[model samples]
Target chain A: MSTRTPGTDDGSAPLLTLLPSTPGGAAAPAPERADAARNRRRILDAAARIVAEKGPDAVTMNQVAHASGIGVGTVYRRFGDVSQLLWALLDDRERQFQEAYMSGPPPLGPGAPADERLDAFLDALVDRVAEQRALLLAAHSAAPRARYHSGAYQVMHTHVAMLVSRLRPDADPALLAHLLLAPFSPDLMHHLSVEQALPAERVKAGVRELLALRDRPRPA
Target chain B: MSTRTPGTDDGSAPLLTLLPSTPGGAAAPAPERADAARNRRRILDAAARIVAEKGPDAVTMNQVAHASGIGVGTVYRRFGDVSQLLWALLDDRERQFQEAYMSGPPPLGPGAPADERLDAFLDALVDRVAEQRALLLAAHSAAPRARYHSGAYQVMHTHVAMLVSRLRPDADPALLAHLLLAPFSPDLMHHLSVEQALPAERVKAGVRELLALRDRPRPA
Candidate 1:
């Protein structure tokens, strides 16, 4: 947990911050905390490396500790379980994405046309999936609960639903929400990317075509 | 297995009934023929009774045997396995439906506008799912191999893909096939019907609205 400082939009707080920890040196920990912060960063960075290299399922607390050059007890102290560690990794990624889309200019955020925003959102989503391709696959194949009810999934549904509502006010917003997220679904993405060996660009193209076809008018 | 008389449909051989042998039939052995047939009839009747009373999961082989005053091995010999038994029961129901939809009348089968066929197919599908509601639920909760690769699913997809192609020659027929079937997926249906407690008619109406929305022209 990161600590919170007032008027800071840097997206971090100190240890025990509600969201993510602020990385600045302004509110440096007054307690025996500088070492802990360093340890936490080391653990997270090591976890990410292990996840990227060996996939999420292959990552164990002992492995993270070994990779981070810390005692196994420290890894357990940082993240209580493998599930929590995996979740934290995904949450951090999703939070960064949401901040980008919400505050960044044009297409993904609020400065561009709804149509383009929809397209850009789809592209960003597919790219994110591609980047975390290995971890996402491992998590899902492990259990339905691991995949379905994660905070990342909830955030995605909520974010996509908001965008769909903004973009297509006349549509069945909830169903549209489902449709928008459908392409990024685990099963569909895995089928396209890994199984079909399709390039990410192709999936993005299909998304464009789906949007066009879905929005097309009926024959007279 | 029921034996089909060769070329009966082509008028080269006389039609012969192919259902499981009943009592006083020529296929029966002389000793204990009447008793065996009677027990078989009793067992099937009890199986149906148990399913109707307590749903598909409750119609276990042991239960069926006990209900019919027979041994468990008798149940096993008759059905081979629970999956086979379940498939047999559902196949009996599905044959009636396939016959009706393939050759019966307008709207559902042929002789109607292509759009009407699409609409009627959805209505019939929802109705069938609702009619066999318990069995459908049981099947989904069962093993994946038993649930997903059933011949029924293949037949439905093929039937739907064929019809949608005819209806929308300019459309991406395969994608439309998925879109059309979206409203009837077991997960979707269960989510709408059970979790949401939505009226089946209202769900059907919503589906109709969705199709209309899909068919509407895009904003230029």
Candidate 2:
């Protein structure tokens, strides 16, 4: 993990900062020392692992502290509570995802063709949502429409719209991108992956097929 | 409006029946008399108008009764309460929509080619969701994931999947249909139509553009 400042690392800084806003309207804290950043990373990783194994509802501060081998007081001090901690985890994952698709590497990041990058980004999105399904679902349930309003969704929409504009200059990339990303909503993902018991690979392939739908000629 | 039996009017019987299940498991009521059916229609029509003019939150039994020009007792007797009444309105509209798409005409119905039918169906779906945006959003908020499990969604999904299968025999039509339908989710529709204030026609066009995405040649 790069130990850079949380929201300022990339062009997505504005939206990323909206993810884990400080409670009580406190002024932004001073920059984290290297050790504090490392601790934050460890706490978050441990929390994510717990969420992966148990589910978001099962995450308690005590369990997170125990799992991270950090003091519970420090965990509480850093995160304030489980809800805030979970948001932080979500923000953390989203930042990493933003970094990957924004500038980290080719295909998902910068160098690949627009179509290839679009495919890569969507495929990676499927994995990202699946990896954090429970947490995402929990957050989604709290406010369903808020998903579209969130900074994360805006960033994803922006990225997808950029690629879509390149692929189909004649099309409305902004609206098309929203429609394209609609399938990856956490509730739908849960229904497909958990309720219908579909494999993630199958979901990714279906998304690709939807993308490649125009590749086939319309019947006469 | 056809005064046909609520769930038995078409092949969507099973799913349609799931919509307006009685609050208490008091065995299914007997078929309505002609006058009773007419009154039910009036009540539902009145409620739908209120929902359209104001919003679902503004619907009240007394208001519906007054709008339908029927006694409040009759409205209560037929529809039970505001919640059940809203659902019946949804069911009533869905039945009409289902009838239109299933066997009513050429394009959204059966006579047109599968691709045209697919386009027509999605276009109609945009209208359908927009018309019932408030009620559908409330239903979705009540249980976000229950959408996939709902009879209405299932029927729509089945229809879309069939069209997709006819359009692309090699594709996984079921999965594609689900993904294709995702953009029409009530929350997203609410965001687009209400929040973003994009006209329904624009949304419909964007949907069509998404459908036509494959028409363009891929960049070399």
Candidate 3:
């Protein structure tokens, strides 16, 4: 009735893949059905399209269902709730970003110098914050209301910490991680961009210079 | 009848000493009667006592009035509202700290080397954040709700910015101001101490090491 994977779930990757669904629904279904997978994909695609058209606040179950050409119940079945849907969206984004940088191309993913990679990371991060500020705010606000704990931010911080540790073994990774994330801090970014009337590119440039300082050794 | 003096009201230090009496009423006083000055001193002393005991949040107008044995109207007369009272308290503390550093002694004051002053500034700032976390948070929270514009934080930032610019003239003062303030950023500090469980002293050590890197020029 039930079978277990040897070491898959125990690892720290957080199991982005669908688990094998077991009999009596003990595991997940041992594996997702082909049609189930298709429906899940369609729901997510529709949700993203709606969010893109309006904003995260405007994307609703009914809208998603309409866009996916499915019943609202199916959307609910895939995501369980609105908060879960938002988490799924953010998690999907986080995973895609990680994969791209970790294995993608010369500048950001791999094969570039550590300094260049660091600069690219800041630039990409600022751009992402500018484009996704509303969605990011929604995800964080929804965090307090989530049924289950959201480990999405923790995963992203850990990934950044590891990269910083690898790039500069002697530096304090925790501080580095905080500094790396500072540019994307919601209140600060909003205050600087909207309140202070600073251009996004100038803000990114300042962040890039700040990170560049970390690459050098301390002067006497 | 209205009265004026060479050093009164317009643009001199005595402007602070001259307290405006009941606006619409006939002029009741000149040079602020001795009793009013004594009461003002008593109020400031009591305000500090209340803040030290109950924190900035709990130092209510009625409480300060009661503690100083002054009328509630007098408290309101002295400071327009609760936020003004709290800001005055913090401003008093910051003023003392600035005086000590600008001309008081070595290390934190003018006698130390520029690099050592920078190092000491980071250490003192981290320790200040640790000691006055509650006041800092209250002041920051109250800033958004304040009715009157007081350029208090701007003054503090400018002081620190000047110190940083002197230390690193080649660096952007505004960005350096942000970087220097990073360790003291309330969200970052709270996250590091409460969520991350880092010992306060260790975080200060990390900051010291981090700021030490500011002096070195990045390789071309």
Candidate 4:
């Protein structure tokens, strides 16, 4: 349910994450199983707090269990290991982000013109990457090439490709989409936002400005 | 002479290597020793052939030694290791490329308009990457993040940033340079060219088309 598969159920998203429930959220609430759903929230929340406060490297099963006021055995049984728990945390946040861009509201969602939608998407992407900086960096470094093939990237690429076609029917939408998304790669975002110390607003603005070339005459 | 040092002469490029002696070939000749510069050329030529035909993964010191008809000990002494030899090959080609764009002729060099020069640079970059696909991919995967911090990248970024400033003085040239160069990333090119089987010309054309939005009035 919590795997990285995109465009699927996103595993009953917003069932218990921090995102304000959206239109596409709350897909026919599944019947409660033996796993305690409330306990899952508590555990995930505790792990997220640990990641935010001390970074992912600091999170341990014992710490998460203690922070959640749950037994260590339950933590182990639920997540299997610290890495899995960290991935779960990333998935949780990604699901929320998908909801916002896919169906949350105007500009970001379905109602705005393609140009504003593109702008809104880039802005939201900056915030999303900034919000999950530590987790994304770790994921990126672990499998740097995997970013091009990841579910999140594919979903974002497909979304961007559609918008590029809408914005410029004469352009090569597929390649242009990849070029547009290039700046948002986790490593670049991490470099600009953290290494270079540019604020999220400036980063967002810079990314948007890159698209300002969309209607110029291309050199032959 | 090149060892991947970021921004520090890239270690006096082309003291010895095999590149076609073109119009932009050869900086001021450096002081030479008794060991014929011809010998350095032979060794590098052998390495390049192996890399092209068998891929960089198949390269070895002994193989280069045998292929170059040089002593195995000399190969070790000259390159320090297999990785260093591969880098020398990359730098050899990179130096030629830098020479072409920085001082060779019209569009890619100094004579053309900024916009056309920008297009030429990217076109040549595509050709450069296509020529050294195997080598670049190896170097990139080995140290993916190093691209941002490398001397070659810094030099390229400087060139692109200057062009961007010329084209749009009011724009954020520094950041736009990074965004513009992002599509040339080794990983993405490897994905598109090798993995996706995209023709080099199409990839080059698609990349140039992305800049079509350059002079358009951005949406307020």
Most accurate candidate by DockQ: 2
Question: Measured against the native two-chain assembly using Cα atoms, what DockQ does each of the candidate structures obtain, in the order listed?
Answer: 0.10, 0.47, 0.09, 0.41
In candidate 4, position A152 carries an lDDT of 76
Q: How high is the CA lDDT of each candidate model?
A: 0.59, 0.79, 0.58, 0.74
Over 4 Å off in model 4, which ranges? A1-35, A218-220, B1-30, B213-215, B218-220
Q: Estimate each model's TM-score.
A: 0.65, 0.86, 0.65, 0.83
Which runs in model 1 stand beyond 4 Å of their true positions? Answer: A1-42, A69-71, A101-104, A137-150, A166-171, A179-184, A207-220, B1-53, B62-74, B81-84, B90-106, B111-114, B128-150, B164-172, B175-184, B205-220
What is the two-chain DockQ of model 3?
A: 0.09
Pairs in clash, predicted candidate 3: A20-A30, A21-A28, A21-A29, A21-A30, A21-A31, A22-A30, A101-A109
- Please give, for residues B168-196, the per-residue lDDT of candidate 3 as tens digits: 56667675565456446555665677667
lDDT tens digits by residue: candidate 4, B144-196: 66678766777788999999898888778998888788888888888888888
Which candidate do you rate higher for DockQ, 1 or 2?
A: 2
Taking the tens digit of each residue's C-alpha lDDT, what string does model 1 give over B1-220? 1123221122221111122222111232346578777776677678668778866655566666778898877778866655555555656566667766777798898788766776787789888777666666555433222222455655665777777677656655554554455446454466557765777787766555445432334548
Question: lDDT per residue, candidate 1, A1-220, as tens digits?
Answer: 1223222222122212222222221333356578997887788789889777756646666667778999987777777766666656765566778777777878888788666776788899889888777656545444422332455655566666676676646555565554355446554566567765878887776555445443334447
Compose the digit string of candidate 3's lDDT tens values, residues A159-210.
Answer: 5666677666777876666645644655455556665677777877666445
Model 3: lDDT equals: 0.58
Q: Could you say which candidate leads in lDDT?
A: 2
- Over 4 Å off in model 3, which ranges? A1-34, A76-84, A101-117, A138-150, A166-171, A196-201, A211-220, B1-84, B94-121, B138-150, B157-172, B194-201, B211-220
Write down the TM-score for model 4: 0.83
